[model samples]
Target: MQPQSLQLSGIRKGFGADDVLKEIDLSVRPGEFLSLVGMSGCGKSTLLRIMAGLETPDSGTVSIGSRDVTNVDPSDRDLAMVFQSYALYPHMSVRQNIATPLRMRNLSLGARLPLIGRMTAKASVLSKIDAAVNEAADVLQIGHLLDRKPAQLSGGQRQRVALARALVRSPAAFLMDEPLSNLDAKLRAHMREELSGLHRRLGATFIYVTHDQIEAMTMSDRIALMSSGRIEQLGTPDELYQQPATVTVARFIGTPSINLLPVEIDASGRVMALGRPLGVSVPARYAGPAMLGIRAEDLRPAAGGFAVKVLRSETYGADRYVTGHLADDQAVCIVMRQAAGDPIAVNGEGLSHLVFPEQRAHLFGADGNRIETTVPARIAI
Candidate 1:
């Protein structure tokens, strides 16, 4: 079997009294693109640094291939990192910058010395460096910008140079720390497509860190969702969006976010929200206080349902997000509610309650696990 590109076991970090990462354990298969996403200060960057051998963890171990690299220096990790700032050398041309890693990795002190070094280096070293640099530039489509200095390049061009620098190394893995954060929204989106395409062409393992769920969903083979120094859940975008293990992950992923309503399940495992049955078939003992989670699209403006007072609505070209309240019950709270002010029955005519489709209801027990089965087989409350 092929070795994993990267591995972390019991990874943890702290700054004085504050913990930064907590027991991170995951692996990136060779040639797979994995993304680490989380809110600020959630240790996503710290984890990436540790993986790149730039930072030491308070505890835990990191490995590349079959070797334990827990204390390895950053230069010795056989890894390449693309920084968010695109850390290109302002004075160096694109070619020189991309050649930097190859030069440092393969050349001796005398061999790396400008003209003198070029003449002194073994014939083989120059050829290898030249080949690697050209190949990298070609792959990143920066071959045309090889003569341009960082100052002369656009943001996207500089980004490509940074990527070229990393790619030329032919490292075992690639670590990217919000590499697109510096680009404008459109460019960032465009780069996302290009980077994913590049990853496919090279088949190199990629570990990307970002706080944007859209980036994570669109680019990753799988994602490790971090929150408060720990991974909340690790899964594919579809799995995460449709079957999130916790409410925090659900709320963190979606744009409009999942709306959560406080609820209670009776002794018979019948769930109720705002005094209306949610039709969940839970175990008899696992009843009492609960929460009901559903996506916005799961709701429809139909008849014979709870009235959703339209508090507000926002248009997004293709669709509209209508926000409102479920009457006067405080227990029917929207966990990620954006609705403000008075409720609007809107086109509901005279509706008073937002009737939830019992079949689509998700029930979270007190311990936070989704209840396997509720009282009603037809409903998922």
Candidate 2:
């Protein structure tokens, strides 16, 4: 097994009385691409900052390559980060910008000068820096843009220059904070493909932080889903989608999101929804009020399913959504929808019956914790 290149042990941070992060444990394997994702105010950005050594944590240890780097300065941590704003030097040429780190690192206090340095024999240092800068530009396909300043570059070009600047140093890992957020929707999608290809070419560890679930789902090997300053779940996209550990995670992921219905358990370990037997075999501990989580794909018209009137139908270009209201009262969970042309089940009068496949049905107990159980048999109405 490869050792982890980046590790955060029991990390925490807070702003005075407000807690921004709880004890968070994260690991990034060497050459692995990991994404930290969550909504606004979820501390995702804060965590990324901590990883970059830009923000000091209230408590916890940060280690890189088996060495503790908790007190290391951001610049001394030997890591490069790309910001969302693409903070390029407006007046500097692309080559100068890309060579900035190397110049800063290679030059001595007495040798680095505006006029005096030009007369000194620092040819070797300058040559090495130029080679590194050009090599990184070539790899990023930005060699042609080296002579242009940031003002003259397009958004994509600027982004590649920023990436090239970061990569020139050959840092241990790349830290990206919403790097693609500034791009338009179509460009963002295109960049996603390009970034994946770049990752393959470099084989370097990537730690990306973003609010976009699709970005995390498609690009990362695994994701740490954070919420309210704490990690809610950590797993693959399929794992979280197919088997969410809690209601929050289930609701957070997916295109249309999963529909959760209020339900109750009977004396025989059976779940009752809309005052009818669901035929779902719930756990013995389930009783009183519980919620039934059903994905849009799991929803259909019911022959014996709980009856609800259709409110409306939503149609997209390629898909039509069948959304409707349920007779049950309490909250909006009763309302549901599914893709059109689904053979699942629905009443003729816009009534929605959640007909989840026995193998696909998910059960959550009254405590909001998902209960592990098999899907209930579909009854033939």
Please write out the lDDT profile of model 1 over residues 260-308, one tens digit for every residue.
8777889977777777766556777877897777887667654567655
TM-score of model 2 vs. true structure: 0.90
Residue 326, candidate 2: C-alpha displacement in angstroms = 1.9
- Per-residue accuracy of model 2 over 204-246 as CA lDDT, tens digit each: 8888999999999899888888889888888988898999888
Q: lDDT of each model, Cα atoms only?
A: 0.81, 0.81
* 10 residues in a row with least lDDT, candidate 1: 333-342
Residue pairs that clash (backbone atoms under 3 angstroms), model 2: 300-345, 301-345, 301-346, 310-350
TM-score of 1: 0.91
For residue 322, give model 1's deviation from the true position in Å.
Answer: 1.2
